[model samples]
Target: MINLQWQSFSKEECAKKLRTDIAKGLSQQQAASRLRTAGPNELAKPKKKKLLVRFFAQFCDFLVIMLLTAAGISFAVSFYRHSSDYIDSIIILAIVIINAIIGVVQESRAENAIEALQKLSSPCARVVRGGKEYAVPAEKLVPGDIVILKTGNLVPADIRLTESSSLQVEESALTGESIPSSKKAETVFPPATPFSDCRNMLFS
Candidate 1:
């Protein structure tokens, strides 16, 4: 696949370089072929750690290990002296257990928050294929697919517009600008243009 400087290319040039028809888009068979070649358009989630593993990981801290060692030594000394009192060793072990539980709970909550954000960002896109528009999962989108963006719709993938009318995309996530950036399909940019200045393009 070619690494295109998409912003530098004209709308027609992009369509040509992608081997797609701007008007008709890719045929069903062509889209399927491309999908197999390009794979799904989604971020790969990190492999999740098992709950037991996560719980045990909390004890990997140096301080926790040292405390555990101290508790074990204290219990041994009490046994050697023929003393029945084990309160100090027991208290230390209890504190260590509580701390581990707290750490696990916090880590689980953070994982849940990240998962929620991913779910929120995953969106369907309206795409043109075989001269007809269809609402499709963003992950199913292949390169050269023509996408239609409406107000309030998330940009599903990085795309160069073939048409636009009063298009303003909120790119604060990427550019850190509070205001929506105006987009024009006819606008052409030079090579090496800053991403924030590529008014003709939309990024996911």
Candidate 2:
């Protein structure tokens, strides 16, 4: 694991420890090698269930199981009493199957809509490599890479501040605060300080 104590180190110290130039950032070749070793910088998405599996899961509910048992018993009793009574048992079984299918379809549609919304909210970033800046998807980021943050830009990854000029970050997603908090580059807090109070770090 890349356990960097970013808070305990100064800007120069961080550059030395990370073995990268602060102004020029990592060279293209170096960044590529690190990326291959560390893998993409992204959150793991939940695996979606297969459609058939999800549909069958609806029939596993307690009520559905009990209804199936009752239907079987009714059919056995009806067949012994009179031929017309057997039709009633068939009707009951049909209704249960129809209800289960409807429930599965409705829930599947809701899950698909949520996934579509998440795709729209994916974030991108601007980074400096070999002293040249480029716009790339946030997942392409790697450790020791220099990211340029501006107002209204989402933080692409957990980052340490090397330079800041009137930097203010909106951290409501992490801290639940309503206002954007001011940031500093030189302040080092105690190890036990709450995450919301760390003015020098930004998290994705």
The sequence of per-residue lDDT tens digits that candidate 2 reaches over residues 84-175 is 67766777688778978898889988998987987687788888899999887888888888999887888999988888999999889878
What local lDDT does model 1 show for residue 50? 90
Model 1: residue 91 alpha-carbon error in angstroms: 5.3
Candidate lDDT (C-alpha), each: 0.92, 0.83
Worst 10 residues of 2 by lDDT: 1-10
* CA deviation > 4 Å runs, candidate 2: 60-73, 79-85, 105-110
Please report the candidate that would top TM-score against the real structure: 2
TM-score per candidate, in order?
Answer: 0.80, 0.81
Candidate 1 stretches with Cα past 4 Å from truth are 50-53, 60-73, 76-87, 94-121
Quote the positional error of residue 65 for candidate 2 in Å.
Answer: 5.5
> Residue-wise lDDT of candidate 1 within 63-163, one digit each (tens)?
99999999999999999999999999999999999999999999999999988997787799999999999998899999999998888988999889999
